[model samples]
Target chain A: MAARERDGLKAVPYRSAYRRVAWFVVGALLVLGPVVFTPYWLGLLTQVMVFAVLAMSLDILLGYTGLPSLGHAGLFGVAAYAVAVLSTAHHASFWVCVIGGIVAGTLVSAVFGLFVSHVRDVYFLMITLALGMVVWGLSYRWIPVTGGDNGISGIPRLESHAGLPVSGPTPVYYVTLAVLIVCGVLMARLVRSPFGYTLRGIRENEARMKSLGFNTWLHCYVSYVIAGAFASVAGVLWAYYNGFVGPTYVDLTASSEVFLMVTLGGPGTLVGPALGAGAIVLLKNVMSAYTHRWLLILGAVYIVTILGAPQGLWNLRVSSPPRGTRRTRR
Target chain B: MSWWRVALVVVIAGATLVATAQPVSPPIKLGFLAPLSGAYAQNGRDILNGLLLYLDEIGYRAAGRTIELLVEDDEAIPAVGLTKARKLVERDGVHVMAGALLSSTGYALAPYIDSMRIPMVYPVVSADDLTQRKRSKWIVRTGYSGSQPNHAFGEYAYRVLKLRKVATIALDYAFGWESVGGFERTFVADGGAVTQKIWCPVSVHDFAPYLTQVSRDVDAVYALVLGRAALQFMRQYREFGLKDRVLLIGAGTTTDEHVLPFMGDEALGVITALHYSAALDTPANRTFVAAYRARFRKIPSYYAESMYTGAKWLVAATESIHGHVEDRAALVDALRAVKVADLPRGPVELDAYGNPIENVYVRKVERVNGELQNTVIATFPKVSQFWKYNPSDYLKQPLYSR
Candidate 1:
């Protein structure tokens, strides 16, 4: 499982070009998603897009770098609730509310990331797991603001930017698409940059990066904050789309959902999680709608999907191999 | 295109084909915001059924205009419920809404009612703020008033049935707190000694931890929780042999049709206090019972009864204004003046505060005709919102003492 790379199909190195073409097609479809689906169906797809963003962001920490801090949902949930509280309670503009959510998710993750980046494997995971639980507990008990187990609701919608005539599903879909595109592009550029190499160096052997006289913690911490920012954007979309946020968003279960998404589409492929999220969310919605035994079916599907395609649903055969063994190419 | 590209395009085209089959509606559809797809799905489903029954019976016409309903499942999460409501009102253009079977959603959707001004006629949100002094006009209850069931239980237990001591175990929420709070006010005011109270959160799946927590000295244990959570609590309550030891009784939220069908022998012989017992001997009730049985192949719950009643009364109120609901003030006046002696719940009438003041029935759970339900034992006529003891004085504090 660890050996596969260059699109996780070690036999097919030129598959990177195929991956680019696949992404282009997916991007076009994403833009046309609203026209293709009704408000309800579009709403479900919007959730898929949101989680896709989350899973991609998580890829930075778990894939690009080996810091598998388990409490990513803490940032996600706080961002969601922060948007709700800020917009409804403080009457901040939607964009301001969103920035507030991003800042919150980043700062919260950064402080904890600073502390946890110093630790290795199990300790980092345990600290994050603990922090996630703490956030969940606070949200549950803090009835006045978080609305307790009830959650905060009735958040206002963000209107069109620059008089683009944004009012309904089409606008929200476009906005979400724009956010995902920008973040995806930014992540792609960041991963291909020298900083990306440093993060990969840390992942391969933090000892080597340190021996090279580089502060490895800074890279990991910086990537963690970036992931946190991306996650908070997803959170903002969730808050607006759902028009609410609760303690459950920050709970261990939510953290597990991210883990599931990532595992179903893991190991350094940026856009793989988006497909993974799409598969999981679509299967979940359709299966739940059809049968009473939906949870069982979902569990079975997750296991089957995981076992069948160890490299995730995206890495199934699409193209032939490159000529050379490997080349870190342009 | 290559085989892989063909497969990809086929997949996308398949998704598009699936998406286009469902038809969207006009009429600013009233969304039935409910937890219709989870454990509490039955209750939410029934509530939506009640709404649908109203829509069908009246030909989808309300106040001389066509009305369409769009139902969204909240799955009983406050966040999900809130999201569903906002989507219904904002994006879906639902004029009004109701449901989300959990009390947590009551508070979640409250601000949205104000935000939209679409006037959600809550099917079963008995939260105090919903009908208390801080009540919103946009939020009308076509269901049981929160404090009434508790006040009824307490009054019947202490004043009429002459029970001396009472204890309570309830979900910790506005519903549980208000239910028991209403009871404590009545029981304590009527020279009754209230022995104990237990407040459990919604997630406590097991009740054994708190079953023995109630003292054996109390006359009866008032069970206030409901749904699968309530079912689990009751099964364990009886399994521990405490049901026979201390008589289990409360506002009958669990003992009613919404949950009674779900609880077989576990709920046998439990006394409950409620406004609508499935056994209420009335022509309107019999019609309701028969129609509900025929439509859903199940007995109607008190929640269903109240919803049906609300619909019937809403129609009646509209007719009183001669179907000219074009005047908002007049419609409200008509709603306030509603009095139906022949409704399913027995002599339903709204007081000055728009809360229903109806007769209370004391029912003992006995399997009649192979189904567990509340059988009427006693009746109290014209029970008011302010019980023998006013909760405004008592509900001020968070918790009550011995």
Candidate 2:
């Protein structure tokens, strides 16, 4: 009964030109948006770009692995703390700290993923939630080390680039935009790869993939690690951009916000999640400029969006014109 | 357009707007860099509302020019603090930036603003470093320090209440660390023995663990929690039967505006060290309160009072600069000349570090006019965070560079 499909997910229609247009739009934004706007807007745009990276990471697990892990924020927080402590306490170089943060996030997610590989369906979400709480506890209790509730402040900013001090928000925006573009391209390529096809196969029918001599659990485990690694990069970027890291990064809301971005944008699409994240981050900042009841308004919008745009915001925005590689599952 | 063009356009447009927006007749541009969103939004908004009320009351113009406010939300995040600070100074082109409520955010933004040569009149932040150690050429505080209330609490404990044994239970953060450290040093020097210190993490929802660890022999407990934690601790502290056993004096902010009403009976009789007692009987205080009530239809907070002082001071400095704020040194000199003695919180002065050395009051919450208001029992001699004894010595201590 469980094996039967009442309806199958239709494959996404492929469009290379559409992909080019998206890239062009992103490029245009990087240059024109910063110059035409103020430093405040540039800084605000940078934050949107950061959250977009995080949304893309969650898409890996939800879209590729078909495992909707609810606790990705735990990985995000882990990477942030790793970077902050390593750079601030251990005095690690910037590159070393970034790499260290990614590695730490991967390790943490991998350990949890190993146990979670045994659980299926709702159990996966429950186990991930529990694991996320455990990480939060560790950050809180390890006060002497993590700086506890006060958060790790006075974190050094990117003082210079390649030994040259890059002054102004212009340089910082360019750097962040470049990183975001690179990450987007990599994610798109990953989704188009042979490995990606196999993961989709697992998402479609795990039992069938198992019968075909493929260990579906290994696929899920690997996806978690990759997603965790990507999330770590986002976390490290957040640490660098903010110049401070707090335990709130590890909380449920962080994970929930990421989850919202993916689901709200287009959970299974490569670029859709990023668009959703960018939209949310930008709007959240601008929304406060208008009213103090942002949370109330956000709550109302959440209720309205889930009802209206449940299929994803990208779908709503892009009319009937379709995009992405449509792989038919036989 | 190519990607490079997009990036260049954004940078140029933003910079252009900021530079050109500088001079407008009387040239008073007021910008508030408080958290208008996120966790501490309400507090920032409260101060923002209060200051705007004063602005409206004062006709929102000073130095013969209309005042323009550019507000940015710090979101109570330290990381967002400097970015917002930079954006306000560089892009929004705010001549005077004021009112960052979080001490950590103020501490983080102080150096960045100084480097840019924009004098920031910090409102709500009580971190001692913002004035003492982190003192900059372009920064001034119109608010009290984290330890101001503790200065009075020390005197009260010694002279009036006669409490010999005390214990501090504070959140494990900068505000917590500095407040408790300041209070303990003063209280202990006055022959009060601090028993055992308990540090609760900021995210803690329950105080059972901390309450269980409190020593039974302590004569009083100084609880330092703010935001939702304060409400939780108050209810729990009373429920745990600890209120009767020991005096539940706060480290000041725990029983402030946000948590006071929600805390109810548990908050009654509890003492807090605050710069503004909300019930100050002075004429300046009365007028400030009346204006605040008319504008926001609510009582003003210490946070709001500080923001008002900072805003008024910044406006006075703006008049001195005569709309030519681009001259960094001139602007710095203009800021140094700002003196607001008739402030809502009584007399406040800015020393070299730009921190306010003001009166610290010890007030007990009493039922008055069908509401719990801070009843001033004693006010300490005006104390500067550059402490009478230490005098910026503690500021000289190396900042936690790590």
Candidate 3:
């Protein structure tokens, strides 16, 4: 027992030192990535950051609260469409577009949360799927507003708002990096908070949390809204970066894609989803460049990811805390 | 070890240098972008095969430069299309670009191509405004507009077919809306009343709900369905027993050669209008059909023919410039200025809007020599994007939608 405590004490400083180096390298890469990579790669990196934010937001619900949302893309797409319409049609200011988009996404999430907070497991998944399909149908059928299948195009990049110079891929990459870092830090803090512990407790045993007088439904509702807001942030960034928005964003393919990111990246940890997003975006773009059978290859990757690393790629190295210690953390 | 050995080596090096004295020109990179995956893969593959066949025929050489083809799949998404287009232009540094199967993708890539100042040939996109109000300076379309063939068909339907009443059903998107709008305007002008209109979503799996809503009293039903939906709609229309009663007529794509082989007796007697058909009995078409069939072992659809002719058009433009495609403005001007009378699709000339003015064929689906074909019934020669309407007046109107 004495030797085990000594080993734990010796490992603490080494882990901290390793973490510091990792942070330094990550910071350097984030700062220099745009400069080092070509425009195509820079564009891809921006997309990765956008999807990272989206996947992390999904992790908050699926990982912590045990709510597997199949409609997360609906939330993301609503914000993107909202931003696209405002910026392109109305020519609204950046602040107005951002605020309006987030609010629209949050409102939809709030309504969906009311219907889903009480449900569990497959029921929650089904309800979210139905709600998402409704959004997709609306976006596709409402021709005048949404531009139907063609979608609204030519959305200008931030347009030098406040003289930020975000017109090109390089500038956009920095902005996306900033957003990802902000969202990542906030999510990391959220998952380590007492509220986060309560969410985990609920995920572990909702009935037990209910008996302890916790309003699990209210917590779930609030978390859903928060996740939606974060997703909206990603959506707005995507709209500005891509300069286009379409119904495909809200489709089942997109929903399943984000779900796969969370599942494959390692749920319950914010960083895992981010890593998963990076992996998927890279795999998709890089593989397509070389071969036409990239989708088949992607399917193989998914099967291998599931079969080989069921606990996720992130958990392959990091040792998760024991259940007894996990509860004692707070 | 010897002056004799050094002298022989120097002589051999000199002989090799003299053999390669002429400067070799860099290969002209041509980027082909389309939906190579997803729902539109078949059409996309046909386009690529058609393009490859033409390149193969010419030995992939044009304007004294070796033409290097770079293919990218847009995946039928606008954003993906734009990204792939960027990679083709910015990364691959393609001298000229071509191929966009979907109208939405065509619209999405136009502005970007214009901003990048790259000459692109759109051989398959049928969006109307692409050559109308939203015409791009850097792009020229070798294919027919969405409403181009329909304009002539509507007039022919009212004047020749003597249809007094018609009902329209189309996929609920820009392409479908424009097609129906063109037909309605011309048919209405010719004293024909459109009795009913039905719009079905692209995701529609069953046509039973929409087919029952068709009015029995109408002279004909003008339907504009595409791809798998076209197959399902034709099959279900026969199942509903309405095929015998209603005179089934549609846009050219409703009975396109791409999906014609899979169709059964339900497709017979269905009249449609389009710019090209594999059954066209021209010498150029015969040569093209034979070559395409030999290579692909399948009948060349209008998609294939368009790309084939599109390749011819690009070659003509490139040759006119004497292979100096580095001059972007000259290349685009050459593309717009080229007019050919011997194309497989018949005579094609670009109008001021960079749209092709070509023959629109009113074809009937008939069993010809144990195979289904869009047999030409009537030809409306030199039909422009504006049809009989004034260009100014047409531009004054809003784009068709819903």
Candidate 4:
């Protein structure tokens, strides 16, 4: 794949120009997607973007920090339920609900991080998986607050944005796009920071980073919380988009899906996870329409990815930037 | 030459207008939402098969318009149900909706269906509030509510059976609570005592602990275990030696046809209550049973019968309005006004709240031709979700809970 990319890059003199034009077209299409596509596609794309944010957040922990937190959906679902409960029960304003969701996500992440900071690899995975199941149980059994399995519904979308009405799927799509862009940029910067290099160093050799007088625990803990906060953002967007939250969001299946996104997208590359989220979401919603055996197709995709492209679809390209650079660079 | 060309153009325009003015009706799109793949896939498939059977019998044409069915799997998840609901309405532009299995999915979908002004008929969702306090004008239910049949069975257990002391064991969930509540309310009202009540989790694999707690002095044991738990509970009930001591009675689902074929002699002599049983001997039901068995090669459960009847009810309403389903309000009004007398489940009519008022059958698990079947022993005709209580008074009370 690398050799093919090198040959293609050499063969095409205007490769960068072509990339620039491609990006512009993609950006413009996304911005005006609601105008051209039906509301169904818009709603679907909004979901893809929301999940992309979540997958990117998981990438921060699993890809960058080498923390395989299987229970990441716990953080995501906490935020979603928090926002849903606040908006539906308290009738709180939109900003208050979003803030509450982020805080709830971050706080839970902090607590989970504190507990799992001492563990790594499989142990970390097991602990996170259990913690995620705990959240799922809470959501399913806490009937009064979470509405149990029926879930809390009829949550209004962003009622207003800076005095402009934001009532329909079209507006929701734009808001999700904006949030995705902001999260993508911030995550990109975070991954390239000195702190990021330190995480990679710890991932490479944690004992060496500790010998250099760095608080390796603090780095992992902070990154864990940060990833959770971003996941919460996605959760909040999802609550508003779907106007509902249920126990399924906190279950192990959801956690595995987000983890799958990171692995399938090229875990180390932030862009790769986002792309993977889009691919999986589209595959699910669209393919299921044609065949009920779409999950089997998904299983096939995962197996092929593991066997064929261990680095994910993104790094398969020769244009991938050198190591230690901004992860999104092509 | 100029005069002839002008006349020719006028004639072509006249012919085009006449061709376009012919009465051409669009096909009615029906969107079906259910858990097509998951733990509930069997029930979902049954529902789909039942509905298809009915449509097939009618030649898939309703009220002078062809029916175009669009099926989407919710995977038994509420969020997925809502997403599919959106896709069905916004993308596929289905004129009517039907086929949801879960009470949770029904509730999750009610608000959205109302907001979209798409008339939906639920065949199997039994959530009480869907037709009670949280009732929506756009939604109609042809299936019995969670406690509908249980209420009738409870009355029978006290009055006809003359049971004085009954102990109950039910799965710990909303459905279980509601089922037991109905039985308890009527039994206690009719001057019978409930000796003991035990609640088991839905994931419970063993019933020994709860079974051990059943009081020995009770005249009979009333249970509401469902799905896989039903088989396990029945087996353990016999294994623990209580089956010989006390009569085993339960909600119709405990020995429903879906799981009845797999049950050993453990299910024999069990009495239960449900709206529809394949063993019903009515002409309507006999025809339906024969057709459903021929098509699916299995006895139709309440789930299949409910959707089958629901499809008939939907078609009745659509035909009543001559297939003008494009008018949302008229379609919903037509649904509310439908009174089906010849459905496979017997006579069914929508009560004031748009839930079916149908017959609740008290069935006994009897061996017929060496196969266990729910034979209709007694029938409570025109049973409502409100049971015997006045609608207004029933609305004032809290939902049935343990």
The candidate maximizing lDDT is: 3
Worst 10 residues of 2 chain A by lDDT: A1-10
Worst 10 residues of 1 chain A by lDDT: A321-330
Candidate 4: what is its chain A TM-score? 0.91
True contacts kept of 1: 0.35
- lDDT by residue for model 4 (B362-401), tens: 9999999999999999999989998889999988988776
lDDT of 2 by residue, B141-220 (tens): 67777776676677678668888888878987778877887777778888888888888767789999999889889888
Q: lDDT-based ranking, best first?
A: 3, 4, 2, 1
TM-scores of the candidates in the order shown = 0.76, 0.84, 0.93, 0.94
lDDT of 1 by residue, A1-330 (tens): 112333323445576567667767776777788777777677767778888889888888877777676788888888998998998788887568878988888788888777777776678779888988888888887777776766676677555322455576677777777787787777777776788878877877789889999898888789888988889889888888666677768888788788778768644667677777887778766664456477788889788876786656555443332221111210
Candidate 2 vs 4: which has more lDDT: 4
The window of 10 residues in a row where model 2 chain B has the poorest summed lDDT is B393-402
Q: Write the per-residue lDDT of candidate 3 for residues B82-122, one digit (tens) a residue.
A: 88888888788899999999888887787688778999999
- The C-alpha lDDT values of all candidates are 0.73, 0.75, 0.87, 0.86
DockQ of each: 0.23, 0.26, 0.54, 0.56
Give the 10-residue window scoring lowest on summed lDDT in candidate 3 chain A: A1-10
The residue pairs found clashing in candidate 1 are: A242-B83
**Per-residue lDDT value at B350 in model 2:** 71
* Candidate 1 per-residue lDDT over residues B27-61, each given as its tens digit: 43556777766667877777777766766778877
